[model samples]
Target: MKHLFLTLATITTLLLLLSTPPTTTAANAADNIVYDVIGEPLQAGQAYYMVPYDYSDVGGGGLTWLQKTKVTCAPYYVSQENVNTNFGQKIAFYPQTPGQTDITLSSILNIVFSSFTPPINCPGTSNVWSVAADPATRLNFIELRGSRGTRDLRTWFTIEDVDQGGYKISYCPRNRRVDCGSLGIVSRDFGRWLGVNGTNPLTFVFESEEFFLNKALGTKSYAA
Candidate 1:
């Protein structure tokens, strides 16, 4: 009778354990926290200035500031300059999943330059960044979405925290697992442009617009 009672108790405990939902732990909480340069958690739709994680590595003594190429229709691509003009380009993220307030690491999202206004003659209507072949260079480069189809998997990207310490952008369409690469700078005749380089991607940090404004006013650090 004792052996039977012990067996029954063990089975009951196992059943209860299997039925309980998994609880959120500290590690799960950490997964949700992606901090900007100001040290605050990054949120969807918030504007930020992305600067090279190692500012000194950029050419011409300028930190790599992401800006758009001033080209004619169908080739308005994203390029980086080695200089800081004012506060630099403002970027924002839109998570693919609806209603998600905070942008988390490894989440599929659409990156957009908050200040870009497509030219009247531009081919695509979208300002959302997408990886497409540059008509001019015939090389795969980041360009505005739309002409390539609204649902193109190439429009999707993911943000991940690099093991070496900063955030890196990667393009790995869910539909095509084989199509994957990390974004880095490539030197062109015009200037350094953003491209899907190999494994060694350029990592960057986000600075809040408000932080720049406050610093300009001689105010204390925004993180303070």
Candidate 2:
């Protein structure tokens, strides 16, 4: 009788334990996963095509795609393309945290643009996204760098999900602590440029490299 009672109690406890769901702490719950266009989690070091959030919203007469172009035959500044082009669309994201393969919202990371191909030769040092040190421009213009880390506050950026729709990129380097600035378009030199300013931040989406290649090179749309 005693053995039977003990066994029954143990079974009850096991059933209760199995019925209870595992606890998810606030920290874990708050880590919102940023997904790609196809609803897959974005991974660091993987190439992605950064496309503007809404194609029709950007009323500028052309596609609002991010691309690289030199202003005065110098360092390539990130510029907006009115139409689609083969070059300057590929970019890779690097997380600030070590061993962090999955990119989460509000996490600090470095954006690096891929190198330019033939004919469009522009001798630049680095492709890591960084702000220009131009005192005249208030360091709003985005430029490329050879290397960047936690120590260099100018290199760190954060990805945030906009309330309206899509996501927006911000740069808030650590100066004692992290202070992010909104990234938006600043019109200059008869061109739309990306900079840290009061203008509306450009809402954008990440299209996986695979889809971009298929749509750009092949006939399949790969809509998702």
Candidate 3:
């Protein structure tokens, strides 16, 4: 009788554990599993594409479906050979438009969103980003590095949560202790959502991390 009772209790415990859902993580938002490209988490100086994704899409290994052609921020120019070099390597983004006293992350996001499709529709652009993974904080950040003009530039970004392409991005605060508590983020590309003062960190999300498991580099649209 004692052995039977113990066996029943073990079975019940196992069943309950199997039914419980695992805690969601930053990378696993809504179970958005991006496997990686050729053992990804791309290294610094290694070129990759920064393409655009729809608000309802979490880009990943499912091929012949997700359109990989919408890269909004990158500009393309024809080479002398008459071939277009994918977004012309890495391009530098202006921190602020010329002669602007103040700017919001909303404006930047709107610009990128608009560029994703239409007048400024940029194609796949190959670029490199440097990783800044801190083991202590477990907060890994990346900075896009490429030649812009006479000087090379590095743009810092941190990705958090779901909404596919629409996630939260903010530069690490210089103060290091300034944390915006419960700062809610929305999904509209254009609006007066989150503003930035000189002191406050600019919060926005760009399609910084686009991945592919078995696909080739410079991958564009795929039709199912």
Number of colliding residue pairs in each model: 1, 1, 1
Highest lDDT: give the candidate number: 1
Candidate 3 TM-score, C-alpha based: 0.27
User: Which pairs, if any, clash in model 3?
Assistant: 169-204
Per-model TM values vs. the true structure: 0.75, 0.73, 0.27
Residues 1-224 of candidate 3: C-alpha lDDT, one tens digit per residue:
99999999999999999887777554254243221223223222222333322312322111011121246553321111112122212212333234432222322211121122223233333232222333554433232222222222122323343343333434443344433221222112221122112122222222223432223354744221
Count backbone overlaps in model 2.
Answer: 1
Question: What lDDT would each prediction earn against the true structure?
Answer: 0.70, 0.68, 0.29
At residue 133, what lDDT does model 2 achieve?
A: 52
- What are the per-residue Cα lDDT tens digits for candidate 2 across 1-224? 99999999999999999988766754474457777877888889888877777666653321233334445545656766754442236777888898988898888888877543323454555667777655665546776654645457777888988887678888766562423577776776677777775264677778876777777787666443
Name the weakest run of 10 consecutive residues (lDDT summed) in model 2: 59-68
Q: Which stretches of candidate 1 lie over 4 Å from their true place?
A: 1-26, 60-71, 84-87, 134-138, 146-150, 177-179, 198-200, 221-224
The model with the greater TM-score, 1 or 3, is: 1
Those runs of model 2 whose alpha carbons end farther than 4 Å from true positions after fitting are 1-20, 23-31, 59-73, 84-88, 116-124, 176-179, 217-224
Best prediction by TM-score = 1
